[model samples]
Target: MKTTLATIALLVLVLGWTSEAIQVQENGLSFSLEAVKRLQEMFESRGTVQQNPRSRSSSSSMCEDPMLPQELLPLCKQRGASASLARLAMVPMDVCEICAFAACTGC
Candidate 1:
């Protein structure tokens, strides 16, 4: 109970201390609506850049690397869609795997 109360008191004190840093001064709001609207407007103003046929053909569909293992080719297909899986496929190595390979060499 005492520890919980101390934690709460510390949290309150830290929050109070950083209130100014986290809040907007003009209207006492955390975020400025104008800035958000401007960012939205900027994206809207720029519009979409249409890809040429050549660029479209060169996109993520070419994720299959000839150097990569055949089993990993399927995982590479979803590289853009799944970051963690893509990372795993790209770096499919570990200390244990290296040790096993070294043992197999009989050196």
Candidate 2:
């Protein structure tokens, strides 16, 4: 009985950690994308090329293009609409400074 209880506790702990890791990864990506957007806008306003400094310009362009990557093509074939929709839904949102501040403050 004790062993069973311990197993259950371990499973719960694993699940919690998985969830937290996913959340943190998502948040970090969101924050990064937001920073990119802001930088792009700033550059555009100054008549400079608006590009992500961290990412390869060619790769970014390819991702934005209508044609999907060959590697992702197979996944799309296997999962179809569900996988595509999930990917779309998980696309990172722009990070807000106010949100970041609040998160840091534990608000």
Each candidate's lDDT (Cα)?
0.32, 0.36
Compared with the true structure, model 2 gives a TM-score of: 0.25
Worst 10-residue lDDT window, candidate 2: 22-31
In the range 1-107, model 2's lDDT, one tens digit per residue, is: 99999999999998766433322122222223333343344334533342432333333343343444333333333423332323332333333223352222111
Q: TM-score, each model?
A: 0.22, 0.25
The most accurate candidate by lDDT is: 2
Candidate 2 Cα misplacement greater than 4 A, ranges: 23-107
Q: Cα deviation in Å at residue 47, candidate 1?
A: 34
